[model samples]
Target: MRVLLDHNIPHELRRLFPKDHDVYTAQFLGWEDYEDGELLNAAMDNNFAVLVTMDTSLPYQRNIDSFSLGVVVLDVHPATPDVLTSRMDRLVEACSRAASAREVVTLN
Candidate 1:
């Protein structure tokens, strides 16, 4: 699936996704200034299927059910390359669930 790495997530984390999953960061897309909803819309417009973020509040703040683009919350505090690397399995699973279900998938 085409995935967008939200601004809050470390850009380096893009390396965590599988080879088949095409991924890019908000900064790379020139969307680092976008808000949650606007970012989602922009990602959707560009045909991105899932948005990976560390901002856990996005699911509560946005009504994501109506959009085809799904949001996957990392659910990690003080997000770091090492910390996120340890949770790679959960992140990958959540991302797949988000894409297939088209809903908010939170890692806890």
Candidate 2:
């Protein structure tokens, strides 16, 4: 799967995802300045299967359900590398399911 890690997520965390999955960060794609709606649209345009973000308010702010690509929102307190690393398994699972169905999933 082609996954996009939002600007809020640590760029170094990209290496933590499964090897079979291709992961890129917003900064890596020169998309760090985009707004939420534009970012999602760009992801879809670029054939990204899913977008992983730590912004819990994204769903409420944007009608993500209307997007063709999947959205996996991470709900974590103090979203540090260690905290996110521990939840990799669950995050990956959510990403897979969301990508498969083009659904939005929140992993806490």
Candidate 3:
């Protein structure tokens, strides 16, 4: 899957995913200013199949059906890299199975 990760998510987490899959960040896309809705559109336009975000309000802020981009919301504590790194496997699995259309996949 082509995955676009939000800025809040650690960029280093990309190492945990499959090298065959394309992974990018909001910062890398020059979309740091884009809100959820705009970002979703950009993702679709870029052929990104899934989004990994730390924003809790995204699911409620935008209509899921509009963009056709699946989302994975991380719930790791912001205290340290170790905490977030521990959840990388689960995130990868979620991203692998994510649908083509809009959907919110939450991970705690």
Candidate 4:
């Protein structure tokens, strides 16, 4: 699976995904300035399978149904690397099973 980590997610968290999964960050993709909608569009256009983010408001702020990438929202404030790591198993499982556009998976 190809996972795109939103700008708010710590880049260090990329290391926690399964070894076979390809992970990239918005910052590394030169898309740190992209708004949520724009980032989702780019992820879809790039054929990213899942978009991992810490933005709790994303589901309410945008119509995810319009995008083709699955979204995984981490339910935690200040989603530091350690917090994300603790939730890595669920995140990885969500990524592995992600299919269909607009699929949403929440991990705490």
lDDT of each: 0.88, 0.93, 0.82, 0.85
Candidates in order, TM-scores: namely: 0.94, 0.96, 0.90, 0.90
- Candidate 1 lDDT, tens digit per residue, 1-108? 899999888888889888988999999999999988899999999999899988878888888987888789888865778988898888888888998889898886
Candidate 4 C-alpha lDDT tens digits along 1-108: 789999888888898777888999999999999998899999999999999888888989998888888998888755666677787888888776554445887777
* Model 3 stretches with alpha carbons more than 4 Å out: 100-102
- Sorting all predicted structures by lDDT, with the top scorer first, yields 2, 1, 4, 3
Query: Candidate 3 lDDT, tens digit per residue, 67-95?
Result: 77798888667725788777778878777
Clashing pairs in 2: none
For candidate 1, the TM-score is: 0.94
Which is better, 1 or 3, measured by TM-score?
1
Model 2 scores worst on lDDT over the 10 consecutive residues at 72-81
**What are the runs in model 2 whose C-alpha is more than 4 Å off?**
none
For candidate 2, the per-residue lDDT at 99 reads: 97
TM-score for candidate 4, please give it: 0.90
Error of 4 at 99 (Å): 3.6
Clashes of each: 0, 0, 0, 0
